[model samples]
Target: MTKRSPFLELDGVTVDFPIYSGGSRSLKKTLVSIGTGGRIKRGGGRISIQALKDVSIRLGHGDRLGLVGHNGAGKTTLLRTMSGVYEPTIGRVRASGRMATIFDFTLGLDFDATGYENITLQGMLLGLTRSGVAGLVDEIAAFTDLGGYLDMPIRTYSAGMLTRLAFAVATSTDPELLLMDEWIETGDADFFQRAEARLKTLIERAGILVLASHNLALIRHYCTSAAWLEHGQLKAIGPVEEVLAAAGLSVANAALAGRQSFSNAQ
Candidate 1:
């Protein structure tokens, strides 16, 4: 029997963002640095940030991978790289199957457009055809329950209303590979339960799920494997418990230690 190909593969993938340290504001200066592989030197009046450095991972079908790290540890950067929003400055990323990402739910929405119109706009931005988006409008509108507000310009909606509209449109479609920065929880208690159920269903339906989150319990519950990142490098990758333990976040071990301490005191 032959082995299956990876649904997602990253080998030595690095991402760089230019830092203009009081240098020329000209496009030419920035363009010149794009191909330099994020190199920085003293007195250059320019700097480059290696947001991800030589990060590698592989995920086949049915894999739920969690990413754990401190802030500015390249967790979000890696997710953006996987979603094709950020191209790797060096090395490569190969992803098979259709990919859908739920990061920044309000991104790409037109404030001037009506809620219904923005549904078509956001859906198209997600790689759906016009007809494809049209088909989803009713489903999204029903899920959002915006009713008359759906015909009003998005700018007129309150912040919570806008969030509802965005979440509805985002989760309306399914994809082969799903990427999320963090678990999305919204609304009051009544609505949060509904959102939680929808989120659970979405995760269950995806072929592959890569989630970057700070919630250790949530990660352990949903992810089959995990990776720890620090300073733009992968510190560890393996079973969820092993990776979490290596990252000094052993929840189970800590609980056990707490019990032992209490017993000794008794």
Candidate 2:
């Protein structure tokens, strides 16, 4: 059978998060019309925040999309929604093919488990069968360079070691649709170089990629198109350069502008 091409679509999606005040009289005054990203709605004695409002996007095989926005702009929320972590309250998400998400490297890790055991655990959580995980064990182990430490419980591992282990396992499988929140950085220079190379290979192999990041240069390098989101609404979507220009970001000033936007949002 010929393999089907990967695709992802969100139609008229709107995500709302209900806020429970627990009958606290002060809660209503404190949260109403406050904060960024979403609008607060109060009706029928209920309060809710609309994280995404009427958002629609469709991506097919070979489409590399970059999401750009300031903090609380719903970029991460959108990525999570695309990964099926959050179902739209008022719309639909349709996707085809095996999907992989890099939102949290240590998502399924257990600190008390030995490195080798955690490998099996995390692999299974990533949708791999037990036998399939067994096949990739040696490769993932070697990539981490943990050696005999693989026999030790992960709680004893340093932060860098944990990062190496999680990253190695997360990238073990080839995915047709990949979603990432941002570029991952490792501690040591040597490991960072190796991880970057491996990450490039993984991105190249994916049929579709949706990456949410504040780094314009990184997005320009990896994505063919871009979407600018503001306050949970998509402001613009088109070619990377055009969208970046529309957002008043240029390669020369993107880094500084990104920093300013982040700070201002906070």
The candidate that wins on TM-score is 2
- Model 1 misses residue 175 by how many Å? 0.5
lDDT tens per residue, model 2, 87-186? 9998999999989999888987888889999999999999999999999999999999999999999999999999999999999999999999887867
Instruction: Please provide, for model 1 over 137-225, each residue's C-alpha lDDT reduced to its tens digit, 9 standing for 90 to 100.
Output: 98888878789999999999987788888988788788778998877656567657777787888888888999987777778889999
Task: Identify the candidate with maximal lDDT.
Answer: 2
lDDT, candidate 1, at 71: 70
What is the Å distance of residue 146 in model 1 from its true position? Answer: 1.7
